[model samples]
Target: MSAIRPAAVVVLAAGEGTRMKSATPKVLHEICGRSLVGHVLAAAGELEPENLVVVVGHAREQVTAHLAEAAPGVRTAVQAEQNGTGHAVRMALEELGGVVEGTVVVVCGDTPLLTGETLARLAAAHGGDGNAVTVLTAEVPDATGYGRIVRDDATGAVTGIVEHKDATDAQRAIREINSGVFAFDGRLLADALGKVRTDNSQGEEYLTDVLGILREAGHRVGACVAADHREIAGINNRVQLAEARRILNDRLLTAAMLAGVTVVDPATTFVDVTVSFEQDAVVHPGTQLLGDTHLAEGAEVGPNSRLKDTRVGAGARVDNTVADGADIGPRASVGPYAYLRPGARLGVKSKVGTFVEIKNTSVGEGTKVPHLSYVGDATIGEYTNIGAASVFVNYDGEHKHHTTVGSHCKTGADNMFVAPVTVGDGAYTAAGSVITRDVPSGSLAVARGQQRNIEGWVARKRPGSAAAKAAEAASRESDGEG
Candidate 1:
């Protein structure tokens, strides 16, 4: 944690991103489970500012509603009109009670790649150099549309900023462009913003004008070049959004890898910011770990799995599965095409095999629900075996009911346990049985109808059919043997 704390942070999110062509506000567009503005607020919040206010204009209600949830307790200033950056900051200062002291940081909300460390460094640079205003500058290869940072030849101090539309030929050649991010002396900024005029070609009050106003007032104006240009990159349209998303995801995956999590194929794996992995956790290709999911140490998940808000315990293995709001215990095995829905849980050493669907159910320690089973609203005790093609019939047209299989039970293949039924400990169910009533401990329940045969039925019903012909041939062979 850096010791530098800003007096306030004004985030400008008032621009109407027409290029994005989205019904949703540009700042509200999400990347890795967080809105673009939310990412900015998180970085700005790290500065521990005394006052943090966001200026919202385009899609104000939606952005404000999102802010309420994303950063509760952080204030917002509404810019009723889509004006320039100068007006946005003025609105934020007004919402901050019209007076602020100490260093104030101003940033754009669409730059989700900006980090807390960079903001802290900027604030520290402003305070340490005793400058009235310090603009964040980047040297980009193409500076066609950005404001050019003008520096004095004698002392290399920032003299002013010239917007691209208003720059001279020589100024346009300058590669050092303004990032539109700044750290300023609070009192100086509040006074300088008052003198800013809408005299530019765009007929809007450019925030860059404040730099010249402060410079002419005999206050020192400086510039801090960002270490990386991408950190200050802004998102305007879908293309830039995708680029930023890729960069941020790469950063997250790299950090996770450095922290002892093994991402087998980082290019194909996607992880949310809220997801966490313990040391030694391994994630396979084509896996998406999303929304507060956690992987314990030694857990291995999928070549093609997507888990949301789920927990996989140590030593558990999940392959080719989709699980949401589920829990798998240590040493448990799930999937080769399983679906674990909300409230599904597998105890230690339990197994859920291919084509199994578990919902609102629990499999106890050492139990197995293997292949082609749909188990819902049920619980199976320790050491029990739920055979292939089994169904826990939970829905009854009006309500969903529960089923229970006690410890050490052996359930046979093709079994249907109707809801509101139970099988006691050590009990067994015969194959092809439909169990409806409770079975006593150590007993065998055979609920299917008795077998019966009707001889020559196929021959009488269809004399020339394939079944009848085969029956006639078998009868001739039997007669010859007799």
Candidate 2:
């Protein structure tokens, strides 16, 4: 492909997308971490055009808000009325100040699978052939809803395109359909759009009419057939959206596998476009790696795990866990059923076991927080063992506080640490204790009350019940022994 930059790239997103049945604009619907229009803009941005414009309508506020965050520098044009594609491009041209001399590439916002490489090829072909207009076309098994490309029989030149609604039975039989994507000579496009009339069956101006108008003026018109028809697929509803997502995910996973990442079950392992993996990283079945998650070499995430905006260091393993905005250090292990919330950090060789939840806490190297624990807003030092069913009671009504457990500390099972407290290095806390005060180094802290047994309580409290009957039987046995 030649290094030809487009003068302007106009994205047609102004359609109401009635078929989508969505309150959100069709172009704002997402697949694989990117909205439909966002994907199109990304591909168009690859051309490095002097001007990039998105024509927005029908929920423009939502789409505009998205663009402000996602692509702040790109310009937008408004199509106030629900006109046709021709009117949408006309608005984009007006936004560009109507002075474009180089190649102008136009693309539909709904086509997420269209690649930058293909767009570049279209632009190159348009420029190389000196064509007044060049269309991106595809030959499909079904042309039910697409525009049919009509070509001259003898010269093989494209004559015009007919929308499926207006196409005759003979023309509808043509397998080669217009993709609604084009690369046009900028000045000629502007001149031809003016001649387009709202005389079609839908009473709207059709961009396809421009091709016919330009051809009538003796200008060369060409069509570039896409290699894969799937690349031209559009998303209008939930079903198509899901299908597109599957295709895109397959592509992403295949590329990752080719790059040396091990995906145990590609079909069941879902990954976002923003996720990255180092060589030797393993993702097991039913795992979803989303957002900016990164897995270092030798990291293993398993059978039912979802990690979002998290980083897993080398040699770490996360099993059946759900983590968000967390960091797992090298050689660390997390869960068969753990939840790691934002700001949770596990150090080297650390372990967070089954049914544990960690939030806004840091577990030091060699530390272990075993099953049935909730550690929140706390810091635990190296070589420490946090026993099962322990709770870091860091919140009290209005404010949140922090707890600190020092190096080599041993916290017993069912222990609770009250916030603003500290356990010094080598200290031990007794089982079932609630430590409200700090413990000095090398000391044993016990905050639990002495155990006492209440005799005959069950008999008095529950007469004629199973527990009371059992107590009476035991009392009779005691009397016999006496």
Candidate 3:
């Protein structure tokens, strides 16, 4: 058995996709948290290509910068003119120092859904058949703007490719269209690129012309029908860009669903590629789980929530909550409308309830910081009840201080714990109180002034009152009856 030769990948991203109607470069458009060009580079990286080159022309600076970040060490070439695919690939070939020996897999950067499996298969077919050029073709429902494949009826050898605008009536009716992706023998491809002519209607050098040139020169040319045509779909305009995003999201959602996660509404949910969900994890509508997020088993995530860089423990429920960089323990329940900021940690079975915001704080197990509170730069012990509308007044205009509430404490509604303050274990605070100093353990803390009531002074003070007028009228009416 002979060893399969090495391969290099050439990504064509030189053209400015003006049809996309956006200021941003087309290939830089994002899908599933990655740019279209980045996805293509990722696919090529999977095959471990010996040399990877990207041809950039329009918005070269932007494209080059993106490729540098996304795929470091990959080569780049510039196509000065608005030439066709053949010219772009040729420019990429020129950037290489020596002749490429094995194969050159040409890919379009606008195709985000193109996978490494298909590229490997294309390269394999080219090597196994000992062919000079192998074109990836698909049968589309409408071949209107695509190039149609022309094959010999007897041998099924690809004879040539005819563009839709230039094809005859019979050729235009053919269903199989060229995908603009190919695997070519390195030397034969280089030789054929030189012979491709700019004599077509567009007067641009079409890469499809290379196949016919190789065939006429007595080198074999073959075609491989792609398993899924959607993988080869290209993004040209805004509509197609949106379609690509939809397809990529669908792919991610499908994978997540198949991995034992229950997505209540796939249409409304947006899960990033880096997010992971364990079995029995349930995701509700309008939820977006982004960067570095992980949901443990039996975790229920909301009717409307956004979580990023957060680890949710098993059997936890987050409803209508928004959190980032937070760690939530098992059986924790958060929000009908809560916002948890970075460094927020909730212990097991703890509750961060409606209209609450917790930042850089930690709540102990079984504690309930339920509705309408702001807890920041503080720590609460287990089994404590943080009354509704209570606040940890950590900021005092000069500096921020800490509030510590010991275990088994019960705070009153609307209480303000002015910081540098501590509420001892088993302590209780009166409603509407503001505590500025520490309270002793097992004590009842009350800071409000005592209330007093004054009565029977209204008649003299307000003789013109409606009550006085009504009483006087009643007395006159009784006297007249007597």
Give the alpha carbon lDDT tens digit for every residue of 25-73 in model 3.
Answer: 9999987778899889888787788899999999999999988887889
Local distance difference test, per candidate? 0.92, 0.94, 0.90
Tens-digit lDDT track of model 2 for 57-168:
8889988999999998999999999679998999999998875788999999999999999999999889899999999999999999899999999999999999999999
Superposed Cα RMSD, model 2: 2.1
Better of 1 and 3 by lDDT: 1
Q: List ranges where model 3 is wrong by over 4 Å.
A: 1-6, 393-408, 417-430, 434-482
Error of 2 at 185 (Å): 0.8
Residue 281's lDDT within candidate 2 is: 95
Q: Please give each candidate's TM-score.
A: 0.95, 0.95, 0.86
What does candidate 1's lDDT look like per residue over 1-482, in tens digits? 45878999999998889999989899999998789999999999889998889999988988999999889998899899867899888898899878688888999999999999888888888888999999999999899888999999999999899999899999999999999899989888889989999978988878889999988989999888899889999999999999998898889999999999999999999888889999999999999999989999999999999999999999999999999999999999999999999999999999999999999998999999989999999988999999899999999999999999999999999999999998999999999999999989999999999999998899999999998988899999989953
Which TM-score value belongs to model 3? 0.86
Model 3 poorest ten-residue lDDT run: 1-10
Q: For model 2, give the 10-residue run with minimal summed lDDT.
A: 473-482
